[model samples]
Target: MELNQVYFWTNTIKDWKRLLQPDKYKHVILQSWQELVSRGVVCIYGFVIMPNHLHIVWEMLEPNGKEIPHASFNKFTSHTILADLKQHHPQVLPFFSVDDSDRLHRVWQRDPLAILMDGQEKVEQKIEYMHRNPLHERWNLVDSPENYRWSSAPFYETGLDEWGILTHYKDRF
Candidate 1:
């Protein structure tokens, strides 16, 4: 939550819907991260965009206007994805609908899991976990971690920032 401090953050879609299974939705998440990075609000060290959730090891470089960078990301991506779904997949919108008074559609669940990374060991562990997520038997998204296009494994393994939003954890250390 504080500037320059690393955290392992996990955010899941409401009802665990596989909304991010589509490439377009995944890109929306990436674009949100890129926007925050461009505005100097966050520096992503590692990330994996899963079908229904996302994991990130990042530093909060600064606040996004009055709100924290994570809050801005949640708000921006939710609104954008919700709008897209409304226009193209209105039937799917009901799955994210809420009965409470806080707006209508809720893309992400409340209180995302954020574990503060106090040392390099913990950071490395989380980075490994994130990279291997897509390779898990349940997902089987890729044979190799680096093969997953939505993860930062390629950057760590081959020293390539294909997505342009990653800040090598070694560099940060």
Candidate 2:
């Protein structure tokens, strides 16, 4: 959580719902990432947006305003996705329902996993793991990792920032 520390993070949707199967929801995630980068809160090195989860390797440049970048991302995307569900997919709203005192809807599970990328080897290993996630037997989202549009594999393979949200990890080294 310290500034400038690189982490390989994984965030799962509440109850692992497939809410992000739609491109619109994934776009919201991309927009949040772009905003954080633009605001100098984080520098994304690699990422993959799955149907129910997301994984990324990023450096926390600074806190997003008063909160950490991850908190800002969760809050923003949850609010946006909640609103979208309330309108077009009311039935889906209950999937995120929470009976706790704080709030009603919970888009993301609490306490996401973040492993410090302490060395270049660790960083490269995580980036590869993230890129190949879509090709996992359980998901099989793409025949090849590079074909998955929601991941940084294409960027790493072709040296193109199709999403315009990537900062090469080597640059920081």
Candidate 3:
């Protein structure tokens, strides 16, 4: 959440709804990252999008406007996902309805985990964990880390940025 510091960020869908199981929803997160990176507000070092949650190794370079980049990211992605669900999947929208006065539907759980990565060892540790997440027994999304399409593993393995949203962690740490 702090500027100029790398963080291992984890945000999950409300009540673990598996909202991101659809590729379109995952693209919503990806596009948000791409926009933030293009604007130089954040630099993504690593990431993985699971069925219900996502983990990112990223650094906030500057504020998006009056708010921190991560705040903007959460707000934007939430709104975007909400809009899509309202128009295309109204039946599924009720699952996210909340009793809060400020909002009706909440896509992301509040107060996501963001751990400061103060050293290369910590950063590397987080990235490797994220990369291996898809191969975990719970999800078994892919047989290998690099085979997972929604992660930075392939980028690190082949030096390719398919989403054009990653910065090699070494470039910063």
What digit string (tens of lDDT, one per residue) describes model 1 on residues 1-173?
Answer: 77778999999999888999999999999999989988888999999999999999999988889999999999999999999999999999999999878798899999999999998899999999999999999999999999999999998889998778988888877
Q: Show the colliding residue pairs in model 3.
A: none
- Candidate 1 wrong stretches, greater than 4 Å: none
lDDT of 3 at 26: 90
Error of 1 at 114 (Å): 0.4
Cα lDDT of model 3 by residue, 1-173, tens digit: 78999999999999999999999989999999999999999999999999999999999999998989999989999999999999999999999999999999999999999999999999999999999999999999889999999999999999999999998999987
* Predicted model with the maximum TM-score: 3
Per-model CA lDDT versus the true structure:
0.93, 0.93, 0.95
Q: lDDT of model 3 at residue 9?
A: 96
The C-alpha stretches of model 3 lying farther than 4 A from their native spots are none
Worst 10 residues of 2 by lDDT: 59-68
lDDT of 3: 0.95
